[model samples]
Target: MLMSGSVSLYTDKASLYDVDYLSKDYAVEATFLQQLICNAIQYSPAEKPHLLDVACGTGNHLQFLQEMFVCTGIDLNSSMLAIAKQKIPQAIFQQADMTNFDLAEKFDVIICLFSSLYYLLDTALITRTLQMFVRHLTSNGMIIIEPWLTPDKYEEGKCAVQANQTANVSLTRLSVSRRQRDVALIDMYYTVYDGKNVTSFQDTHAFLLLPHTVLQGIFDSLGYATEVIMKAPFQERGLIVAKAK
Candidate 1:
């Protein structure tokens, strides 16, 4: 659930989320996801596989995935979920936390993409989240996660910037990354200019940077047959594909 008593970090600019990721190849990624599901699990065309997307921000992936599977998307941010609902009106969108959610239905494939798993911030939380996923999975279901930057790949004091524009709005986002022990911290500043007004906001995001060995160990401990694709298509963060052993 969205944390109460305080405004969520994403509340102000949820509408701009899609504009920020305009260059992402969601269609290609969705194709890759479809292939991964087909190859990883056994299913028939007559019965389309059901898929649940955890932390499905703005439904960008689901927009393309709905064509391939029966899709349901969940996100903790209401603002993000609203945008997703607007974009993919035909599909189901719900407000739910990744660590704990009960939809009362099972799925053939459950995917946590865009490095969302890192938000759990610790191995115990990550493990509990995966356990929840397993409970909601079918006998032959698969769990796919796109992990965050590993320890070896993380670069401290790195600064990145992006600028985007629409007919009525122009925006710039600046990000500076740092490391704190096993966690990676990214502080982001956004400056947006509308035709008549300008505004600025700042947000900090933290992720528990898990190494391949640690992540693989978690899967192994849970009795899953897992594969880690080092050269994943989109983020280069590598992808984890796992099935019940």
Candidate 2:
């Protein structure tokens, strides 16, 4: 299980995650991501790319990426990986930290999406992880990331409530964000009513508000050409694609 950072939310409660993002269009996001990878890989080409998904929470993106590429996913949360494995049985899923993992293989495309990098919360670890991403690339590989909010984009005291239900189960999560210096501290309360039973839990996630320049600087220093694409499925955020030079 993830011992710290934003992964904490999924550590024990992977089942709740799908319900949390029930409104998100992962298929559409995956389509956009495929286009992003398509444009970024002109410098290097692969007929059938081997894609590594870092912090793949529930294989939502990989579900679609697997249709187009050979997919492998890694996440710190075992519970999350369980759901991911069940979804993409054809793909490989492993439990590993973003900063420290050795698959002993390289991929043509590496992706860490849905603001996953913000969970690193440490500059050194972030750089180290990006270095690992570079190391795991096939020299022609491209990296795509969806970032968390920057300082200017982050607003404190924002609250979001999401609820989803099926015939047997109902899940609801109340989330609120607060600022702690460069960190966004989010507190989540989840309630699950499974017809015959009721359970409730609280999870807190802390995400780093790393600036775009700082992120791009690490990519640039690693001999990557970084660009921030203004278009994305999420209106509140954008995608960052960095290609090997």
Candidate 3:
């Protein structure tokens, strides 16, 4: 029951950040992801690779990647997938769990960004997902994963705040009380203000926090040529790039 008691403090809709919120911090995060993709493509031997974005939230990265590559997006959340579909009508989007998910086709590039891989809190599940990724990737294909900070690197009970204003509404969110159980859970509280009214919401979300070394080892065990890049643009975070052997 890790992260069993978590809650999301917003409306039934996905975070406004998914649609309208674009702060400097968010921009920076997007830039970092783009750079990672570019680097992977540059290093990959495959030309015109087919790309898959797992846990593809609102399809932000998919939309960005489609310009240069044939991209497909998958997510478990129907609402998020709906949004993604609207954003990238030309791209293929599907509903699939990150773990225990299978597609008949193989991909040349697979990416799990923004700590989406963290949803599989158990190490065994994470390893299983990695194996699935390997099976679905073509020879010489590469897998890129970005996971949240490990528990040892996180500040217990830490808090962070973000705010964004749009033409129609403004949003303020507070993330507090980081919890480390079998899974990492964060308590998020959000306040949404429309022109005439204000509303509040809360939801708890959980993510797995695996050690960097463990991820590298799993990639190796799966016959991947692995590399680890730590703290690229954010402290306490890292990326793992694994190419099929």
TM per candidate comes to 0.93, 0.92, 0.85
Please give, for residues 1-245, the per-residue lDDT of candidate 3 as tens digits. 11222333222556575633465354465567666667765543455568899988888777767766788998888778888899889898999888878788898789898788887778888899998899889887788887787778766588989888888888787888667664677877777777877877776778776778888888889888887777646544677889866
TM-score of decoy 1: 0.93
Q: lDDT of all predictions, in order shown?
A: 0.86, 0.86, 0.75
- List clashing residue pairs in candidate 2: none
Give the count of colliding residue pairs in each prediction. Answer: 0, 0, 12
Model 1 RMSD to the real structure? Answer: 3.8
- Evaluate candidate 3 by giving its C-alpha RMSD to the native, one decimal: 4.4
Better of 1 and 3 by lDDT: 1
Q: Write model 2 residue lDDT over 135-219, tens digit each, in one string.
A: 9998888898888989898888999998998777798888999998899988987777877778777788889998889999999
- TM-score, cand. 2 vs. native: 0.92
Weakest ten-residue segment in model 1 by summed lDDT: 1-10
The number of clashing residue pairs in model 1 is 0
